[model samples]
Target: MAQSMSSPPPALAARGSQGIILKETSGSRLESTISGSECRVMEFSSDGCQLAWCDGKSVTVMDVPSGAVKYTISKPKTRCIQFSPLGSYLALWEPYAVTKDVPAGTPNLHVYNSSGELVTEYIQKKQQGWCPQWTEDEQVCARNVTNEVHCFSGGAPGLTCDNKLQIAGLTTYALSRGKLPYKIVVYVPGSKGAPCFVRMFAYPNLNASAIMASRSFYKSDTVSFSWNKKGSAVLVTTTTEVDKTGASYYGEQGLHYVSARGESNMVQLSKKGPIYDVDWNPNSEEFCVVYGFMPAKATIFNCKCDPVYDFGTGHRNMAKYNPHGNILCLAGFGNLRGNIDLWDRESLKPIKKLEASDSTQFEWCPDGVHFVTATTAPRLRVGNGYKVWHFCGTLVQCEDTPPKQELWEVKWRPFPAGTFPTPSTSSTAPPTTIEQPVQQEKKAAYRPPALRGKPYTYKLHEEEPPQRVGAAEEKEKDKLSKSAQKNKKKRESKLKSKEQEQVVITRGSKRGAEKDDALALAAQILRGNKDKVVDPVGSGKSDSEKKLKNLRKKLTQIEQLKQQQAEGKQLETNQIEKIKTEQSILEEIEKLTLS
Candidate 1:
């Protein structure tokens, strides 16, 4: 309705039924609270703590961190209160009933500096709209009417209204961080007069809008939409109704889709009856959904609809992934037989399942190394005021405590670096020698598998190690070589000795033949049976005894020569095979290695 020039932000002042109200500081249980209702919403200002709040008919500012009043501005009944992007001024809105048939507009937005003075009343031109919400990042704020929606930027002049575009029943809009072309998906109606329209806006600040897709329903036929992890896709919930009776016919469905892929590809998710609420894993890629209603679980799923955990039925009251996306925590919903499971992404195995029975909200320490959840509710504190409980049996909470007036939306606040699940100390490298064939099987077969010929290969011939030689060792080796040479020579000599032994035997046998011939002569000379050489033993010595003794002596001579030759031969055949092997190996080395 009006516009004013810029001025310095006013010092917050406490007033009647109003007090310093500091909100949005995150924690399980808020460490801060409003000094009283009529003070300014409590904030840490450059000078001191400033608080501000609405008195239904006006807005007041105060410094409750110190007892000082800053300013006050009278306005139409205000519903919600917020500071500017730079926290320069105050903007107040007229309250709306969520179910009220009319939309949210003409809701005077007054920007006031620290002096309780009005700077502007930029009344949005669109008529009949629902929830009007600002992006948490302050980049955009959206307003929706029956089938029309418009989003505006503070930098743009005048109240820009867009009516050509459509959303279903204006269930509301979703805001997120990072770059955009924000997927400002709005729920508008389809051809059948039901609210199932989800449109993605290009510049959230303009009337230039394009229809992304529309969901269909006949009666009570509006749908609500939520963003997926990356804001690239949205999950739209719709109800189909009977045209004749104005009664909802078909049940509810949650269709998931990505804008890049187009909504036609939206996969139909299992209906958890009619979902009252649904939230996806913030780390997006790691998929998990939290739905309202008991016995309904935080079902983990891959991008495909297949569920990850076969332990299918467990409700994660609320869950979050550690910044690194390694560990995940599911809390709050479990029966008598369930565990609070912690998983390692590498192993995909539950490292720990705390049997923490009492379900309360939890927050990660700035370092993702430690996360805290409430097992049992706190008794000494305002048990009703907060849903905080002791962590893993310890009473310690966290660093940033919440303010009582603020509905605490606690995140680990991702320090971005340390807030991920701590990786265990580890190292991975191919070993020095992967000799274990079994292990080789498990490793990814690299470099195209070995030509599978035989289960056992001809033992891969490897080169032998070099022979070591120091002076003393070389001398010993030389001595050994000489000994081997000598033994070989002895073998040759022994071969000659064998020949000589045979000759001796041959000569001895010839002598026997001669003696037999001589015996025949003597027998003939004596003209009777007689011994050879009978005349030589003229005394009492018998010719037969003499012949026997001579025979023994000749046999002994031959026996002694044979024994010597056998012993000599044993010395010569000294492990000839071992020596031959060494020689062959050396020859091969000379051929291959030297060349």
Candidate 2:
């Protein structure tokens, strides 16, 4: 049961029944046409210029300058297909029912990416009626349902704990959206009536395996998270949820100052009303936010320690911190006068205010380059046809030329500033050198091809060098060479010393021989022609001479002594034998008897 209608979509009804309002931009007008599906809202894009509308049957793509219809997309009728923020891809939010039998049950959510070519379908239940957002970096997609926001990481696969969020929020169901190019994610653990107060995780895909994470928490629900280029200052909106009787519980939605380093310095934006969102000035000095619903208001906090711009009160009023944070754009929404207001960063006074025909979602380019507004359909005077709406945001032709696009801040940088630098004269200056400065050496991110760095091991207990076979050769060589020259010299000195001893001994022998001969002559003189038997005077030489003579005459003397001793003994024996013969003859008779 689908109903087709010839009724043109309501000028303001961009989202059918759902009331989806597309944010404004400054680019060329989007292609628009009536579609066949009965009463549906959708936006279409071709070659980038988006033509969006609500409750329309079909969308037509056309050439920009010539207005030529390029292509048309027809389908089972989807909610919307939007050009991704970067313009390289398209994001389609397709909602289909589980079955006609049940209406309140979970519905299947499908996403068609990269120009309707690839689609990934996922079912998100438990917390129903959710609208998800694609993060600017395409790293994650988020959905907002009831009081909590569900975000799914794009790189993750399978059902993991981190893959889902049951973010508890007890505040008013209003969510103010803000994004910083470098910012990731924040988590606040809410307990009961208190606005979610827990750790806010802030890393890009924590290794998918959940090995590590960079997270911090705030004890509140904030609508806006603004970033300073240095990541030092982020403006956070504080909200205080109040009950029906106006009894305030959850959150003191105060403006907070946080260093990108994750230091929380809270600044209460308003003590009573819920400060929807907070944004920092491009210069990082101040921040402003929109609050007070019936009478939308804006307020600014100047310096970290001070209050600068305080635009105390107004309704349907909005404040935008530009991409660069240099300028703050203020626009008022609601009755009386349809006007857009701008404010200077230094002067709190209004510099310029343009009567905006319609809608209030706009911003300065990321470069602080241009002003983009939502341009409503052209003014018409035929038959109460004032119902024309501004499509997607309009591209405000910049009054003051913006910074070059080349200087645009990209979301991520592959190489560090230390590794590469943009062409700047200051960069060429030689870096200062410090003596004995402690430097942390960086390890190689990737392992070397050849090295595995296995466990330390001993090479099978090598034999001691002292007992090795090769040691023998070295030992022999060492022995031969050990102090060779010095030892040879010592040997020569020792041989000389021994020669001196031998010389002394030989000389002593010669002297003894001479003394012995002299002693013999002395004996001859001492005897002197003895007729009266003077005998050889001391036939033995003087004691000293005898000692010398015997020492010299050793072997010959010994032989002569033995011969003399034998001759004397033989003579005595002959005498005894003769005497014994006489006795024996007489004794012969006696001997015979004794026998």
- Best candidate, lDDT: 1
The CA lDDT of each predicted structure is: 0.44, 0.41
Worst ten-residue run, lDDT, model 1? 1-10
**Residue 530 error for model 1, in Å?**
99
Q: Candidate 1 at 322: error in angstroms?
A: 5.0
The total of clashing pairs for model 2 equals 42
Off by over 4 Å in 2: 1-77, 94-96, 100-107, 125-183, 192-195, 204-253, 257-259, 270-277, 282-285, 290-298, 302-305, 312-316, 321-327, 335-340, 346-349, 353-595
Per-residue lDDT of model 2, residues 25-134, tens digit only: 22222323332324344444322244433234443333333545554544444555555444334443445556677765453444444344445445544322333454
Tens-digit lDDT track for model 1 on 261-293? Answer: 444344433434334334455566436555434
**Each model's backbone clash number:** 39, 42
* Backbone clash tally (model 1): 39
